[model samples]
Target: MSIENPQPLSINSMAALVTLGKFLEEDQWFPQLLENKRIYRVTYSGKNGQFVCFAQIMNKTSIIMCMEETYESKVQW
Candidate 1:
């Protein structure tokens, strides 16, 4: 059987994930988090309508890597 390896996360990306996880845990929303294929997407809204940060969670590690922004806003604040 072939083994698949998980990607390593950058320092900034890992930190952001930890922070986001903590916030979600405190808010009791962490359980609702889901992994969509290789990317973990969370529905969030800011000053704009809606946005999502696509991330990959490393297996057997606490690292989370931000891949790319799934949504873009044409309206400039």
Candidate 2:
């Protein structure tokens, strides 16, 4: 799905997106969402513990909607 009014991503989210974008730029293999817009799942470790980041890639830009999973639920990408 296309973003209607894509807002500015948070500082942390922007940093994560930038890191993933760099990786995608180097490999040229960004994640492609099936039936949905292109999506990417980035896993990282922090002070708290391990975490997963989910984002949507559009026009070479990554839009992160949510951070770590709050509860057990199947992610549609």
Candidate 3:
């Protein structure tokens, strides 16, 4: 049996998600929050892993973003 090399792909995918989160905030790309009521969660998946990019738009020029990932081999977040 041939072992699958999935680490590189998973890691790359994780990095991309993180980059996306940063991009969402860079240059004030996100739209202004409508009275504390604007949030978005983006999900991405690879061969053996998946991740989420979470961002909250606070106001016209205020936003926060965070990324989280999980792999098939990992037991915890």
1 versus 2: better lDDT goes to: 2
Per the 3 Å backbone cut-off, how many clashing residue pairs does candidate 3 have? 0
lDDT of 1 by residue, 4-52 (tens): 4446556766666666666666864432345433344555665655655
Local accuracy by lDDT, each model:
0.51, 0.56, 0.48
Rank candidates, lDDT, best first.
2, 1, 3
Off by over 4 Å in 1: 1-3, 32-77
TM-score of each: 0.36, 0.35, 0.33
Model 3: per-residue Cα lDDT over 7-26, one tens digit each? 22245444544564577568
Off by over 4 Å in 2: 1-20, 23-37, 58-62, 69-77
- Steric clash pairs (candidate 3): none
Candidate 1, residue 12: how far the Cα is off, in Å: 0.3
Write down the worst ten-residue block by lDDT for model 1.
29-38
Q: Considering every candidate listed, which one attains the maximal TM-score?
A: 1
Error (Å) of candidate 3 at residue 26 is 18
